[model samples]
Target: MSYAYPRSTGASSLPSYTSVPSSKTTSESWHDLPNVAKQWMVEGAAVFQTARSQDRHDIRRFASLIFRRTFTIPSALILLWLFTLWRGERTVFQESIDACAWENWEKWPQGATPHRVAFIADPQLVDPHTYPGRPWPLSTLTVDYTDQYLRRSFSSIQNALIPDSVLFLGDLFDGGREWATSTTTSPEERYQKYTDSFWKKEYGRFMKIFLDPWMDQNELPIDGRGRRLIASLPGNHDLGFGHGIQEPVRDRFQAYFGQSNRVDVIGNHTFVSLDTVSLSAMDQVDPQTGGTSSVVNEAYPDPIWKQTNDFLNKMTYHRGRAEMGELRMMQNRSEGIQFDYRIVEPADSAIYSNDQDEPVDLPTILLTHVPLFRKPATPCGPLRERYPPSSTTEELEEDEPNSLSISGGYQYQNVLTPKISTEVVTKSGPNVVQVYSGDDHDYCELIHREFNGSPREITVKSLSWAMGVRHPGFLMTSLWNPINPETGESLQQGSSPTIQNHLCILPDQLGIFIHYGCILGLSILVLLLRSSFHVFFASEPALSNQSPVLPLSERRGDSYKHQYQTSGTSSSTLAPNGLASRASITAFPRYPVTKASHDAYRNLDQDDLVTTTSKDKGGYRPARPRGFRQKSVLMGREFVHSVRVVALVVLTVYFFLIWRW
Candidate 1:
């Protein structure tokens, strides 16, 4: 009879072969035909019986190993994914900033400082009203998920880029206008009720996502130059456009986010943020008659348009006053006069100052929600999605209806009219550097040669992923304005601050999910292959007649006896490598089971296979029970593995939860 050892142990434990004189050779035994086939089936059944006897221990060992790896590997991959991809915003944002490094055009002034401004456009925080057909739970989940994404992205920006100020170019909330209408139609009740209910909740959400993490309490942090932490304007979606504009909506927006029409002096340059939405409403035609309104002229009917008009008039008066003051100062200095005087302009100057022969020194960076007028066929750079107009006819339609709109709608307009565009650019003057606008939800850069000496107007892309664009992005601008020594303010006439803009695009979230899917598929494949290997190789050992089934003491010479004797313990107590032995009898050598082997062992009696023996009893003996130390060591190893698995699981959960909450 041949001995078969467990495959888990090495093949060196296999004993030397001992041939039986009457038995057929291992290669020739299979020629017995029917008799050999029957014997082979019997031997196969016996081998299965032997495996079944130890099946409980083997199953437990293999199952524990698989379970530990099942949790361990995936958990490790999840952590790696978060470290590299989920938090990869920092790396990408830094790379974008590096790409737009400032050039050494001239030496910077001592007082001049580089001010980095981060521009966030059209976040449009989602709500249930934004997507009516979606399930309520899904909508809520999306809102929470988007909030988390914004929070993480903002955190990355602060930690990595750390801009001096942030500018939000409108559309802060998706349902800002919706809330106004849904609360109440009456202008009187809408403001109070909207503030008390829906608006309050959304405002809280917005603050938590955008400001709370960085700012102190509710106060807007001001920098050394008196610039606030953030500057924002209202969008068509925020306060509505044209006839859709509600008085309460406008008032609430002003109360919360500050004046829609205002100017900021940063880095000695004028940033004129205008309420173009309300201003454009002046051109709104009566849908029924297609003409202007003429009712209630005494109080200047349609207060929405009147309010915007008043802001424009105030701006004109201020510009004229500033010009006259500068002119007076220059004349006084030239004449060696110390007295101060104020010059009063005639009433007609107020009406015609904007239409002057020489444009004012506005040197403005105009900010508006709606883009200025451009021909319907104007190319908005190669980055624009709808580019390279396929046909010349499609490119040159005067009333294409694809342009922001030829007219106005409920809450939006396509673009400002050519007349209004000329007015704004003319007032801003020939020194207008760049005009930035949003509400297009896509990146569009065009030159409006109609006014301001063809200033470049860039419509920033929306920052939210749900806004139709596949890739979301933000703009980073660096402004450097040198200060004059005589006056603490910026130089009146000199080289302007270098303004450089860089667009930083975020990764596609859907693509991240695809990567996760690949990881999962790979893990499952690994487990399947591992299980298959264990089944075919580890579980079944090879059965060969070349090795004899005998106890070491019975078959081996004095050399084997000397080794066991010198070990200071019996074969049961002492191990080859100082580990306690479990069995007193020698372990059997294993070989592949086949017909030849079966035929050889078929004639042997069951007593030929000696599993255990004791000298005192002089007969078969069962294996000894594991010692206390052995059991404790096994338990310790298992405990360590279990703890490792639990730790990985907890780490994976913690990373995912922290991002959401």
Candidate 2:
């Protein structure tokens, strides 16, 4: 027999068919109703009677089933849509260990051409604060999260089209001092502690996590023979506390990676890696049990404030027509310390045996940790008196004499003067000597004044390390053959003419496009997915109190069947008014279901239901069996609606994986 859902009336809600007064009905005519309709009525009647009986368990089950059929699929579809958008936009970064292959070297420009050198300074590998076994009290300079920044910078450099050699200038470690003792510990223990604690622990772990994989996948090599190769020069910290002394630190460095200072001839170029740190060491003294000290502190007796004042006075007045006399006098008097300015000329007789011992005449390059000059002469004005007299004086006095100013101040005389000798090599023709130094943890390029005349023309370029301050990124240099002047042929060692200044062109468009597109796309995808899920699940109203507002066609057949009961005697057929009423009700207008109406039904109480039915004709209806065919049809519709949602969840997961990669 066909079943129908219960309907609401003005007086009291119509009892379900099951609850209707049952007298033995023998009317064959009533059975003429469609089986689907008959079945619906029976299910609805059962639910209505159970609900009327105040059976909490049955009512709860019916409510839950309806809520699931109504809301679950729609929610799933929304989630799926959000996931798709997320997946489409996400960027997937692939990690590879061996990116640089031997075959990639074939792309390098042919012939022995003077290459551009990029100097990276002051990487400061270990973060002192987190480092194990570090001495108590750390410097104010807190380490930034530089490891990630350097890895990305390296990726950028690798993606760039230019071929280059990298020179790492000094301070490769935060401080060379360590806890391993040679006398008390075994040699292996000492080595293990040194490598594990310093290199493998802090910086090495970072490399393994992010950088090494990048380099391997990109095919960039670190060896000398590899394209875009790298090498290093010792800085003050790299040398530990020893200046001129060949301490254990120096020996350990040599043991690990050959000599600390060496000169390499690449093509027609001479790359001189000087131990600028050693020069500073010559003036340093061991603060703990001070002997004659490793390096002499010439400015020891004189306060730094007074010395800086005198130096500023010389620079301000020596070449200027302007009277900086008042400025110099004010600087001296500003700090009550007496000034004893020593004209600390280079210990030339001691540093170099002969006055005219000229540096090698090849196209030379100098690599050191500190800049040669304190400040380049600026046209706007010399920085000689740039700092207000009081601040400058106080800062200088606070700094140690032999130590190079980590931030603002001047290099010691020893560090400055030796570099001047190196600059002289740049002056000779067809020769361009570029000085590459690190220790500043930033990228900059400066030129020798006499060689190219202007900063733009000068060959010098400075680079910050992959370990220190993170922004602006790491720099790479490429050296290649210069085209011939006369024949337009690249100069060969034997047959071709020498050319000057091989230009470093930036990377091609394809590399840049791929790198940036992936990064931006992935970021957008992640954001969209997160927002969609939040909007749908977090903001939606509850579903239970809401009513299913069906069309008149749906309501009439079910409602009429539920209200009527069969009354009969055997073998007789009779027509009933119920059929006519069902027909008429089916003809009524239909209204669309809304979220607000649905919420109202979901929150309806038994008492509210009684009131609502009396007030609104469409407000109440008998529930159907939890597993009725009508319920099954609703569930099928829900399943169809939820396909989009299921798909979206899958896509979101996929995109999340892509982002991780």
Candidate 3:
């Protein structure tokens, strides 16, 4: 039989093997674990006899993550900027004003997946009357130079936009003449020809300038799709105004592109190419009100508004407000009626984009030549009124199309103009997300904060110079779809388009400031993280175990006992040297778990193994390393802290120097 001590204290606190009586109970023998497990249990029991204290707080470990990523992030940015330089894109911060818009292509937030569409409007490519030796009008885009400018615009588009295809809102041609003359053919024919010669330029030339069907093999659009034919909508200039537009122009224009009112269903999204010119043309009013019939008055009474209304009426998504009223307009305007029609109401009918007479469940995009209306700020603010409405006065003498008054009538309606245009889109379907138009040379993005669902109108800037008031440029929209929300791109499906409107104007020289702000913000974040991690490691609980050393086994002599005193405290010790002088040994060894083996012979029952028995109670002590270990730990921590301070100072100086430069 064998006797064992009570399992009240930790393994490290148990008396030596010789102290236990040589006797064992059947229960203890039957339940004894494997030697491996006893060894593990011994280590586990030692933990209770150890002392530890925690002075650090960790709330999710975010501090360590931030510190580790600091170097990684800056290095990546530097590499990307270097790549941009290699591509001749210029370092993002070093771009000239003219190149800002073009350079924006590379600077867009990385990993954003946008349905990059090339949005260019109002080419208005027609003969602007200047022949050889004639001074170029500030408002004019002469026929000869228009082609050269168009080439330049398209070239820029190819390089900058990287669009899948181009969308052209019309007035593609000024349509005021056929051949540019250096006194060609009979010199007398020019002076004698009717001013109606403006209408004589063939659509063939229009196609070459915009659609570019005859583009040389080398001049083909980069995609080799050959100047991706434009999805077009004719402006008033394309077909003129009122009931008497020259049919030959309409016939020639339609021959190249599809219908003036058409829809292209693309990947569950609908692009409606609408001839608002023709729709506005039908804005016929009651003859009694004295308002003359506008564009295609009676003869070509386009039922665009009505057709669209019938479709929306069939959709189940109507929010039902007086908003439906703008979808269709039926008024009584007699002959020369001129009243304060605060809102330009929609025509009595408008075209709808549908597939086989069914309402589209997909998002719809309305493309038109005449914008819903010009933004009010356009002609009111210092920056906006930069150019007053180019052609506020009507021109009817030549009986030919006047690109000015026919296309841009900025102050034409209510405060939020395009009041009716909004209705056409809203009533079209609850899914209507965007409406794009281009009659105005300036750019406007009217986000409908009041609308319940999506409805944002984007008026694209003119591709070429418009009276030279504002710079000539176009819009670049970078929008994301569902799978791309994580990339940080703006998701237009539920939000406004992630857009950047680039132009020839660059008054902002603060790109560097923005970059610096981002860097400083990150550096401060890294410092905070470093501090947290430093504190966390410093405050880690130390696992301290106390066990009786063999030399302290069962008081051999009074002299040895006299040298050391038992203080009942594991931390209390008397030492004249740097080394610990306690009879009990304490060690902090990391633990690794192992499976137990069921063997009992290894159990100690011999008196030779007997060591000192200790009596200790529960308490917590802050463990301090002794001897040279204490000095080394203090020196290491201070060295690391100093390095951190030096690094922070270096970064501060480096950034300050860069900013000052």
Winning model by TM-score: 1
Q: Which candidate do you rate higher for TM-score, 1 or 3?
A: 1
Task: Give per-residue CA lDDT, model 2, range 461-519, as digits (tens).
Answer: 22222232212333334444443322223344653323233212222223333644664
Q: What is the lDDT of residue 466 in candidate 1?
A: 75
Instruction: Rank the candidate models, highest lDDT first.
Output: 1, 3, 2
Q: Model 3: per-residue lDDT, tens digit, 50-127?
A: 422121224234566566545443344444434432322223222332364434553445554434456767676644
Candidate 2: misplaced stretches above 4 Å? 1-122, 126-149, 159-164, 179-228, 241-246, 284-360, 376-432, 450-470, 476-661
Each prediction's RMSD to truth: 18.3, 20.9, 24.8
lDDT against the true structure, each candidate: 0.59, 0.39, 0.44
Where model 3 places Cα greater than 4 Å from the true spot, the runs are 1-113, 126-142, 159-161, 176-202, 212-228, 242-248, 266-268, 284-360, 373-419, 448-454, 482-661
Best by lDDT: 1
